[model samples]
Target: MAKDDSDIYAALLQAIERGEFQPGSRLIETELAERFKVSRTPVREVLNRMESQGIASRDGKGGLIVAELSQDQLGELYDIREVLEGFAARLAARHAAPAEIELLKEMIASGKLVEGEARELAIANKQFHQQLHNCTHNQYLQQMLSSVQRSLALLSGTTLAEPARVVVSEKEHRMLVEAIENRDEDKAEQVARNHVKNAYKTRLKIELGW
Candidate 1:
């Protein structure tokens, strides 16, 4: 990938992740090229790569659109997340450095300051999970978790959007950290799994407009 192409790719990915290019929204190469002030060739390449990564898909009309997950697909995605996150927490309990533990604690503390701010807390939540993935000390696990996180960006809105969910999620994060701090791998894994489960429930409710 040339520098320009890399830049274009990253920008497009960010746009998708930020929900600017919403799921099922068409990605017209010519329009994207004009929007990014680049040639259609690079836009086409970026779209191709995104399609291969499951970030974009064919619309059955010979055009590309942002990937959309059906309800069943969403449930399957969360199932994978539950297992991967639990394993990451278990590994963190076994392998996280003292500094990493302190960093997670600091992150949780900062998260408290954004209690009522759903968007901020949502971003913080992602960072916290990424830290946990880093603490796992397994590159393969981290890579898989990273891919899951990217796929999650296809879902619009955050579970933390509700103030009640935000409060509950904060407590869940604290519990996981405490379990890890105590070096209780089983407890950490269970807590992390529960957290993902709660998130899945909330997401399902949101999807159902409840």
Candidate 2:
């Protein structure tokens, strides 16, 4: 695709992330074209691509809307995330170098353990996990993990946005890294599994208005 189309798609996705164009919101080609200063042709292409990528779905009657996850789908995604990511951690432990482990350790140590920029903290949290994923050496596993993470968009609210979440999350990250450094497969898998479980707990607490 052209540069303009790429930018428009990114802007649209970011808008969705920010709740500007929320889940189930319609995508009117003309209006989005005007908003992004792009031609309807490119806008249509972007919408088509988003649909194919599972980021959006056809509106049944016409165009497209951001896809929302059902309760069952959310549970399913979490199940897959824990299994795949835990496997990634186990694979990583077998392949990771000392330097890689050290880098992960540093990231865990330096990550904000208290309230701060939510987006930045979330990005850091994501990077730490992605780095662990990278250590796996299996391209297929890497790609599958990426797809599972994209499903995270279905859930509302940043896990990092909650007060005190970073503190708890940082400790969890440390355990994951330590397990990898120790080359303990069971510990790595357990730590990774617990991390997702804790994240789901946070999501539930927030959704329940606790």
Candidate 3:
């Protein structure tokens, strides 16, 4: 890819992940080129790459829009997350350094200070999980999880938006960290899997307006 295409792609992807460009939002090549001070050619190339990655798709009206996952697609994504995240936790239990474990604990502590702030909590939660992914020390697993996470940006809102869900999620994070600290691979895996399961349930509630 050309430098312009790569830079534009990175900026567009970040905007999408940050909810600046929501699902179904139109992606006009001319507008993007204007925003990034680039030519239409590079914007077109970046949009093509995003479409291939399932991040953007033609809206059936000759324009590109951010992709939205169907119910079945969401189910499949969650299933992948449950298995891979559990494996990540198990590996972290075996390979994580003491300093890494301390950092996770510190992150949890910082999260508590942000209680009731949904956006901050959501960012912290992502950081914590990203750190856990790093703790696995498996580059292949990290790469896979990174892709899965990008897909997750398609979902509209944070499960942490609910006060009750936030409380339960923090507890779950503490339990998973404790399991890793104790070097109990089985417990860590189970805790991590259950965490994802609970998150899926919360996401369903949000999606269904329950």
Q: Sort by lDDT, best first: what order?
A: 3, 1, 2
RMSD from true fold, candidate 2: 2.3
C-alpha TM-score for every candidate: 0.93, 0.89, 0.91
Candidate 2 lDDT, 126-160, residue by residue in tens: 78888898899999999998777766765676877
Better lDDT candidate (1, 2): 1
Candidate 1 per-residue lDDT, tens place, 122-171, comes to: 77888888898999999999999988987998988888887778878888
Structural RMSD, model 1 = 2.1
User: How do all the candidates rank in terms of TM-score, highest first?
Assistant: 1, 3, 2
* Superposition error at 152 for model 3 (Å): 0.9
Worst 10 residues of 3 by lDDT: 110-119
Steric clashes per prediction: 0, 0, 0
Model 3, 31-67: lDDT tens per residue? Answer: 8888898889999999999888888888889799999
- Model 1 ranges with Cα > 4 A deviation: 1-3
Q: Distance from true position, residue 199, model 3, in Å?
A: 0.6
> Which scores better on lDDT, 1 or 3?
3
- In terms of lDDT, model 3 sits at 0.90
The models' CA-based lDDT, in order, is: 0.89, 0.81, 0.90
What shift in Å separates residue 165 of candidate 2 from its native position after superposition? 3.0
